[model samples]
Target: MRKDRMILRTPLPDRLCHWAMVVCFFLVALSGLSWLFPSLNWLNGVFGTPQMARVLHPFFGIVVFAALVYLFIRFVKYNLFEKEDRIWLENVKSVTAGDHSKPLRIGKYNAGQKFMFWGIMGLICVLLISGLVIWRAYFAHLFPIPVLRVALLLHAVAGVGLMLLIIGHIYLAFWVKGSIRGMVTGYVSHAWARAHHDRWHDQISGKGADKTKPGSAR
Candidate 1:
C-alpha cells in the first residue's frame, strides 16, 4: 500500500468519472426497469416521483453514454486485442481458478476484459440510438409509429443487455481480490500487477523492451 511499492493503475480523474457514471447508470437503470415491469413501478421514485423519473431518465442515460465515451477514448488502446491476449484466452481456466503460476504475458487489460470493454461500448451505442428514436420529449415525434415501436423494443433489449454485462463486470471485479481496490485507489501493488498483468507490469517497471512513459497509462 505504500506509494513506493504501488503502481498507478487508474488516474484520479478516470476514477471520478467512473464512479459518477456508476451512480447515474443505476438511477437510469432502475427507473427504466420500473416502466418495463409493472411490479417494479415503485422504482420510478428514484428521481423523487414517477413523473420526475420520466423527465430525468433520458438525461442521466446521456450522462452515462458521455462518460463511457470518455473512458473509451482513454482506455481503448489498452483494451485492444493483441497477440498475447491469446495466451490469456487459452489459460482462462487457470485464470478462473486464481492460478497465477504461469506467465501469460497479460497486458493492462486481458482478453476477457477487452471483450467486456467492447461489449459495453457496442451496447451503449445501440441504447443511445434507440433511446433517441423513442424519446417522446425529443426525436420520437419525427419517426413513424412502427419505427418508434421497433426502437422501443431495441432500447429495452439493449438496456437489459447492458445491465447484464455490468452485473458480470461487478462480479468479476469482486472475484479478483485486488480489482476493486485498484479502481478505488487508482493503485495496485507490484505483486498484484505482476500476478495479474505481467506484461504491463514489466513495461511500467522498465523490465520490458517497451518502457511505459510517465503518465502514459493514466
Candidate 2:
C-alpha cells in the first residue's frame, strides 16, 4: 500500500480517454440494442427517449470510434507481438490458473491482451464502415437497397462481436486484482507489475533477471 512503491501504468490522459470511451460505448451500444430488439426497446432511455436515442446513437458511436483510434495510436507499440510472446502462448493455461512461476517474459501486455486489443480495433473498423453505409440520416440514400441491407447485416454482426469482446475485457479487468486499480489510478505496485508483466517491470525498474545483465557483464 506504499505510494512510493507504485509505478506509472496508465497515464492521466489515457485514463480519461478510456473512461470517456467506456461511457460513450455503453450509451451507443444500449441505444443500438434498443433499435434492434423489441423487448430491449426500453433501453433507449439511456438517451432519455427512444427518438432521442435514435438521433444520438450514431453521433456517440462516432465518438467511441474516435476515442478508440486515439487509444490504438497510443498503445499500439506495447501491443505488438514478439518472440517472447510464444512462451506466454505455450503456457497460457498456467497463466489462467494464476501461476506466474513460469518465465513468460511478458512485456507491457501479454499475448492475450495484444490479441484483444487488435480484435477490438478490427471490429470497430468494421462497425464504422458498415454504420456509415447504413446510416439513414446521411448516407443510406446514396446506396442501393441491396447494398444497404448488406451493410445493415454487417453492422449488426460487428456490433454484437464488439460487445462480446468488451464483455470479456470487463471480466478480465475485474478478475485481475490490481488491473482495475491501475487503470483508475494510473499506477500499480511494483509487485503487481512484476507478477503480471515481469519483463516490463524489469526494464522499467532496471533490476531483476534481465537478459541485458549477461550482455552488460560480458
Candidate 3:
C-alpha cells in the first residue's frame, strides 16, 4: 500500500555539521596531496604552495576534528546497536536486493551504519593522536624517537583507511536514494521512509500499526 510523504529526516544542525566535515576533509586531502607527492607538483597550486599547505593542514585538522566530534556526540545514541541488528546482518544479501519482508525493524541506524559509525570513530581517535605526536612545532620532540616513528606510520595507515571509508560512505549514501536528500535538506518524504524503513516510518507517521507508540496493539 502506498503512503504519504514525510517532512524531514535530519535536523538542520546535523546537515550543517555534515557539510562542514565534508569541506574540511576535502581541504585535508588536498593539503596532503600537495606534500605527499613531489611529482604531483601542480597540487601545490590549490593551496598556493606546498609549504602553505603544510601550514594550514594542521589548523583545519583541528576544525574537522571539532566538527566531527560534534556530529559524533549528537548522533552517537542513534547509532547504538539493537537486537534487530543480527537479523539485519544475516539478511544482508536479501536487503541489498531490496527485500523488505521481515525487515529488521530498526530504530535509528541499521547494523551496517552502526559499524561504520564506530569504525570512523576509531579512525578519528587514531588520526588525532598520531597527528599530535608528529606535530613538529608542538610535540614531535617531546616524544621519544621510537614512538614518533610508530606514530608516523600509524598516521599514514589511518589516512588511507579513512579515505577508503569515505568513498564507501558516499557510495552508500547515494545507493539509498533518499539518503543524500536527508543530509542535504534534512528532510525526507513519508513514502521514502515507508519504502526504506517501514517500521520507523510507521512510528513517525502514526500509521496503521506502530510498535513504538504506547497502548498500541502488537
**Which regions of candidate 1 are displaced past 4 Å?**
209-218
How well does each candidate superpose onto the true structure, as a TM-score? Answer: 0.96, 0.93, 0.87
lDDT of each: 0.91, 0.87, 0.76
> Which of candidates 2 and 3 reaches a greater lDDT?
2
Model 3 agreement with the true structure over 163-203: per-residue lDDT tens digits? 88988999999998888977787667766666666556666
What is the RMSD of candidate 1?
Answer: 1.6
lDDT minimum window of 10 residues, candidate 3? 209-218
Model 3 misplacement above 4 A:
1-5, 37-41, 207-218
lDDT of 2 by residue, 25-88 (tens): 9999999888888999889899998888888988999999999999998889889899999999
Against the true structure, candidate 1 reaches a TM-score of: 0.96
Q: Model 3 shows how many backbone clashes?
A: 6
Regarding TM-score, does 2 or 3 come out ahead?
A: 2
Per-residue error (Å), model 1, residue 194: 0.8
Candidate 3: deviation at residue 212, Å?
A: 14
Model 1 lDDT, full chain set: 0.91
